[model samples]
Target chain A: MGESILQLQQIRKSFDNTEVLKGIDLEAAQGEFITLLGASGCGKTTTLRIIAGLELPDSGQVILEGRDITDWEPNRRDVNTVFQNYALFPHMNVADNVGYGLKIRKVPKAEIERKVEQALRLVQLEEYGKRMPDQLSGGQKQRIAIARAVINEPKVLLLDEPLGALDLKLRRQMQLELKRLQKQLGITFIYITHDQEEAINMSDRIGVMHEGVLEQLGTPNEVYYQPRTSYVADFVGNANILHKNGETLAIRSENIRMDGESVCTLDAVVVEKSFAGGQLRILFRLADGQLLTASRYGIDNDIQPGETVKIGWDAKDAVKVIDNDKDENQR
Target chain B: MTKTKTKGNSRRRSGNIGLLIPMYVFTILFVALPILYLFLLSFLQRAQVWGVDFTFTLDNYKRILEPLYLDTFWQSLKLAFTATFFVALIGYPYGYFMARMSAVWKRRMLLLIMIPFWTSALIRLYGWIIVFRSNGVLDKILMGLHLTDQPLKLLYTYPAVVVGMVYSLLPFMILAVYSSAEKLDMSLVEASRDLGASSWTAFWTVSFRLTLPGLLSGVVLSFIPSMGLFFIADILGGNKIVLVGSVIQEQITKGRNQPFAAALSAVLMVLTSVMIRLYRKITGTSQLEGML
Candidate 1:
């Protein structure tokens, strides 16, 4: 296990009678890419802001590199944030904007320019130093933001959905670029995003947040295959839960095979069938009115709507969860 | 076919011209003609009786180069510049604070700023007279408090004129800076702090520069009007002071020296945009140093 670079302990924040964050405890190890994954308004961004010292939590402790930095102002923290909107200075040119932090620290003119050029080059934007932020495209702006944060060489770089505004293809490309940057720099990156794919692909481990609480924390495979709570299973992937005798059963859409290839098989009537690019989504109803969704590719099955079929899954693939006990306090 | 194509092009061109006709007519009627007339009047001789003598002469312009008149021009520039500086100094912070305020407070502050604007400006100036003149409200309050034995001469000073100008032109400066400050992305400030810039440094690098456009517009709005608002000097300074606006007013109504007055008006008009450009340059240089 890596040494913990940052630890957030029992962070609780509320705004105008609405508790945005309920007791979030998160940890990011050195050089680890940890993501706070949640939908919008779930306090993921707020948690990131708390770590960056942009927003003070109502009650919490932020320990960075074994030091309690909770009361420190944002500039005193050893962390930088790549804002969701990039927030690049529109008036200043790229070089000025990138070198602003160095200039503020009273670094020499030549040194500031050198570090700025180096950072820009790292983002593959050596020639864009003279361009204003508005002159650059979305992807270019995102890279500039990354370069801006990366140049500081902070202990942890917080990014709040840096690619949310970009198109799908550009976002995917930047995702890989971000991952490469994280590995190349070897600095801890605490990324916050609502997109499950982005969080799963870029982060070494993801912390799933729901209504301000840290629901679960694990690697993508662990969270996806063995979700400790129903929220994690539903949020991370397509999950169909079957409630039986107070013990909830969670089966991943892909895990529940259409044909009788597993030990547990149940006869079901196909209620709905929808084609989704590469896979076919089939909704089935059991004899007891339990709805289950099974995802199969074209070559895997030929299930159609209104067709009666048998859905089966091995016992190992089915994970049981207690929905009521997990969310009683949160609600 | 070629004739029809040419006709089509001409039709489009004519349609565009037709759409612009109202603007051109309004400009010609209200703006261009007055400027041309003013320019023509500046080059002519003042009549002994009334109006202007229709003769080409540099005498009117040459009269403005006199030492006494030149002093007035210098005084006008100084006063206008001072009032503008003060307006900007006070307005930027007020505007910045207002922009950062909550919605309810923002509306309340905006209303408070506009309250004096709703009443007639002439009326407002008169109200200032009631406060500043000897044995007036200010003197009465001071005397009541026993701060002074007599009326402390609050009325007829350079500071009085400046206060009046700032009072009148403050809304323009505040609103202009507010317009820019409100549109600013606050996250940039946070980003600056995250990048290791202190709160003060972030303000200079992010908030100040981002709001420069608004501040400059405020300067233009306040400075240009202050240069021309001679009534402030006349009323507040007890008619002891004379800026370019009063000089122009005196020339037209009392002195019957319209040509020289026209020349001064032309000078002030040209100076307006020039001052804006020069102020922008000065601020620009200051910002460049700050950036370094």
Candidate 2:
């Protein structure tokens, strides 16, 4: 319930007659880390660009700090963006790259140097100030990019999958680093990413987008546990969807337990068992020939493929969604 | 078995050396031999039937150091530099436009640049003459507008020579810069702007610096050929100006002093090599492979 630092009022954008952002209505509270999470081509990056003033929305206004900045140029707007590729200047060393914005603003040289040092230290790259981008590792370059944006001290920081280029381990580490940076800076963060785990880990609130529309917006648990749409449930986490008497029921794979202990059990056969790290994803074919997946934690029991198994979940765990046919009719 | 392998390697090496013999012969005949001949002629007083009295003197070098010939060389250098400066000034923006243009528009622009190249250089020079001569297209149009009573004296001047040289060498500069600009990652510019720099600052700090190699290559392409070229100066300068190239031509054709011309040619070659070496040093690029 903090003041809204950024708002997109019915924003829409299209490219070459193809709509990319149908009508996105989003608001970010001051110092809140909000993530626009969706799959590729879901208008998440477009929305982030619109907020950064890199792309002009077709209709509606982008209000920043309670001011309408729809026509403001990127530099005039009090926002900075970190691109997915890092886009670190290859010709510049890390210090110059981080101090570029300050130099552009004609800040005092001494103050610029001090802020650059502080920014580099925040990203844990104090000694890499002299290294060119090509000489640094991918993670180091990503940190430099973060330093470059954060050094500006903009009102809102826009990140378009900033860690998308890193490998899995580095990406996880940088995700935590970014979260810490956001908390320390206490600035509004408008982040866009296709990675659901990243959104859940870093964001206080998440907006799920699908095909240029903001499908659902809520906290991570709200979006994951109580998705209003099937796309949201499937996109946020693993969900087993079932059509029961025209209502769409989505049950998390982990919620389905071994059959004997539950009151509602369904007869199914284990078709495929995949050992994925600490959990096993068991694929089962129900009696109605519907394929469903159940995630069993820890090392899976010695259940072979083509073996008969009974799986069940409590009826209360099944969250019913508005049927797609009815929703399409409403649209 | 290893001895046999070694023997086979040596045999392959010898075969490769034999294959290189023709390449060496061609280079000696076409390149090295001419340069050696020029060097020998530069030091000779005159040529005899078989050989001269084997007298070594520095008169050819000293003659060029005199005021008249030295003035010509200095003027030529100044003109070449001016032409090269303008070529880069116009070509960078043109090449940038080409690089950022859509595929169809880029092709059209590239064709526009190359249209003049399709005709002969001599024909183009003649066309310029027709345009700039007294009572020519330009003079006629100016007079028709009552801008001047007499035709402007623009047909034969340093500016005319510079214009001709720049017009001739511009395509080379554009093509050189375009090759580099085409490969640049445009996202970097966006990133610069997104990180709080204006478009102008981003262009200078990110885009321009990245395209430095391209600009250097363009300058070299325009400067070197324009330095040694005399036809444009002779045709456009009304034969009143003398450059190193004109001196060489005059010695070979009218002056009938082959040795002096050869010496001047050798000097021009040395000047070109020095410029190239200086460029390589300044840009931190390698000479073996062309600039990237």
* Best of the candidates, lDDT: 1
Q: Please give the lDDT score at residue B19 for candidate 1.
A: 96
Please give me the DockQ of candidate 1 compared with the native complex. 0.77
- Provide fnat values for all models in the order shown: 1.00, 0.82
| RMSD list, candidates in order | 4.7, 4.0
Candidate 2 Cα misplacement greater than 4 A, ranges: A298-310, A323-326, A329-331, B1-29, B48-54, B145-149, B287-292
Residues A51-132, candidate 2, lDDT per residue (tens digit)? 8888999999999988999998888988988888888888889899999899988999999999999999999999998998
> Each model: TM-score of chain B?
0.87, 0.86
Tens-digit lDDT string for candidate 1 (B220-258): 888888888988999998777889899999988899888
- Per-candidate DockQ values are 0.77, 0.72
Choose the strongest candidate by TM-score. 1
TM-scores of all predicted structures: 0.93, 0.91
Give the Å error, residue A257, model 2.
3.9
Per-residue C-alpha lDDT of model 1 across residues A245-311, encoded as one tens digit per residue: 7678889888887656755468889898888889888888998899998887774566677878877
